[model samples]
Target: MRVPANRRTPLHEIAHARAGDKGDTSTLSVFPYRDEHYPDLVRELTAGAVRRHLGDRVRGEVVRHELPNLCALLFVCRQSLDGGVTTSLALDAHGKGLSSILLSLEIEVGEIEVSPSSPPR
Candidate 1:
C-alpha cells in the first residue's frame, strides 16, 4: 500500500479528469500530470477500489481500462446516477461533477511528485 506517512492529497493534485454519461453508465478519464505516475496510478486505482469508494452510487462492477501510452485510466461506472441523466431526477443530471468528486479521493504523494509550491494541471 502506498499509504502516506505525512498528509494525503486528492487525485486532482496530480491528475486531470473528465466525465460523461450514457444511459445509466458514467465514464471517467483520469490522466496523470506526468508519465512517471502511470504505474503508480495503475497499482492504486483499481476497479474494485473505485467500486468500493463510490459505494451504492455505483450499482454494478467498475471497469478499468489502462492506457499506458497516454498515462491515463478510463473507468466505466455502471448505474452510477440512479439512471440516465435524462431519466434521473437528481440535481446533477449530467453527472458532470462526478469527475471532481472522483478527484477528491485521497492518495499519497511524495513531495517530489507533488510539491506544495507547484500548481496542479
Candidate 2:
C-alpha cells in the first residue's frame, strides 16, 4: 500500500505498536492475494471472508474513495482498554478452500487512542 506523502507514521508502525503495547485499541493492516489472474484482491476478500479471517474481535467497515486505484476495506476492533492483553490464532486457508492459490497474506495490529475532538493545533 502507498502512504500519503504528508503522513508521519512509518510503514511498519502498526506492527511496532502491536508488539510494544498491550491492552490498547489496535488498527490492523491486511493484504491478501486471492488469485493469480486477478489484478485486485477485492473479489476474494468479501465481508464474510474478512469476518471469518479476523474472528469475532473485529467489526468491518467499507470506506469508499473516488480514486479508482485506491480501494480498501477497514476493520475496527476492540482491545483490553485496561492492561496487558494478548490474543492469537492460526490463519491458514484450511477450510476456506483457498490454501493453494493464496500467494501472500499480511496482518498488522496496532494500538490507537482516540479521544474527543481536540482544538485546532
Candidate 3:
C-alpha cells in the first residue's frame, strides 16, 4: 500500500496490515496512511517518547526508512514468553501542556514467523 504525500493518518489508524514468513523471521509491513504524513508519524513514534513506553519489551535492531515524502520505522522486538509479540501505542501531552493536538491515535499490529531454511544452506 502506497500513501500519497498530503494526508495525515496516524499509525494506529492503519486499517489493514499483513504479517508474513520470511526465512526464519516474521515480517510485518504496515501502511499507516495513504498520503504524506506517514513519515512524520513514523519519526515521532519511533523517537524517545514511544521508545520509552516500549521499555524492555523491545529488543534487537530498529530500522527507519525515509523517502522524499515517506517514512517508516521497523523494529525486531523480542517475542513474549507467551509466544506472542505484545505491542501498544499511546499519545499524550509532551511536557507542561494542557491539551494535545492529537485528539486520539490508533495502532495496528501484525505478526509473522521466519522460515527455517532462511539461514545458511
Candidate 4:
C-alpha cells in the first residue's frame, strides 16, 4: 500500500485545469504539469475527494474519468449549476470558475517533487 506524502499542495501547483458546462452539469479536466506526477494524481484525485472538496456546490454526483494516454483526469459534476447558464443568477453561471475552484483543492504530494516553471501543452 502506498502511504500519503508528507507535504500537501494545491492541485493547481501540479496541474492545470479547463472547465465547461452543459445545462446543470459541469465538467473539469485536469492535466499534470509533469507526466511523472500522473500516477500520484490518479491515486489521490478521486470522485469522492472532488465531491468532498466541491462541497455544497455539487448536489448530484461527481464522476472521475481517467485518460491515461493524456495523463489527465476529467470530473463530471452534476447539479452543480444553480440551473443552466440561461437560468442561474450565479456570478459564474457558465461555470468557468469551477476549474479554478477544483484546482484549489489540496492533496498530498511528494516532498522531492518540484512544480514545473511552466506547464507543457
Q: Is candidate 1 or candidate 3 better by TM-score?
A: 1
lDDT for each residue of candidate 1 in 1-121, tens digit (9 for 90 to 100) = 2334445677776788899898889998989887766666787789887777677778877999998888899999988887787789998877787788788888765543445676644
In TM-score terms, candidate 4 sits at: 0.87
**Model 2 lowest lDDT segment of ten:** 11-20
> Tens digit of lDDT per residue, candidate 2, span 3-106?
33322332222211111222433333323222221223343444454446445433334221122243333333344122223333324211222221112233
**Candidate 4 colliding pairs:** none
Angstrom error at residue 82, model 4: 1.0
Model 2 clashing residue pairs (backbone): 26-110
lDDT of 2 at 5: 30
Ranking by lDDT: 4, 1, 3, 2
TM-score of each: 0.82, 0.28, 0.35, 0.87
| lDDT per residue as tens, model 4, 11-121 | 887789999999999999999987877887898899999999889999999999999999999999999999989999999998898899989998877643543574344
Question: Candidate 2, residue 42: CA error in Å?
Answer: 0.9
2 versus 4: better lDDT goes to: 4
Q: In model 3, which runs have C-alpha deviations exceeding 4 angstroms?
A: 1-10, 14-28, 47-50, 67-73, 78-121
Clashing pairs in 1: none
Question: Which candidate tops TM-score?
Answer: 4
